[model samples]
Target: MIKPGSRWKSRVCTAEAVLIRPPKSEGLPQCGGVDMAPVGEEAAPADMQPGLDQGCVVGKRYRSEATGIELLCTKAGQGSLGFAGAALDPVEAKKLPSSD
Candidate 1:
């Protein structure tokens, strides 16, 4: 099981992220449509799909609504973060209310 604080690296790109919240379902997160590998493990060489190279921004948080998975990007790369077959959306910053 992927628990909070676990680190992962994209197999097909330079993207790296930390798991802030684990998914409700059991599975690994995907990047560029490929499963991510644990930080210290050897990842097999794989090619990213053509349209999946939208790029993951550094220092951004992405979340999956379907599985309740959340990730914080630690390194930027050519692959976008995703869960299952859907792309992970960037977590929106909460707006501060104005003081009266």
Candidate 2:
């Protein structure tokens, strides 16, 4: 299982992310249609798919509802995040409570 706080980097682009929540099941997170490797590990050069290069925004949280996996993009890049062949959805920011 990929534990929370584990960092990942894209193999095909400069995308970098930190795991916020682990997936309920088993599977690695994919970026640019390729599996992301852990930080510090050398990544083999790969090609980014045409549509999968939508890009990941820095400081945004992406989540996969089906897998219960969530990741925070620490560094923006030319690749989108996904899992199990499905794109991960951006998490909406929670509204702060109103102060009287």
- RMSD in Å for all candidates: 2.8, 2.1
Model 1 vs. true fold: TM: 0.88
Model 1: per-residue Cα lDDT over 1-100, one tens digit each? 7899999999988999999999999889889989999999999967887677788898899998879999999999888888886679999877889879
Q: Cα lDDT of all candidates, in order?
A: 0.89, 0.89
Best by TM-score: 2
Local accuracy of candidate 2 as per-residue lDDT tens digits, 1-100: 8999999999989999999999998888889988999999988978887788888999899998888999999989898898777779999988989889
Worst 10 residues of 2 by lDDT: 45-54
Each prediction's TM-score versus the true structure? 0.88, 0.91
Instruction: Tell me the lDDT of candidate 1.
Output: 0.89
lDDT of 2 at 78: 91
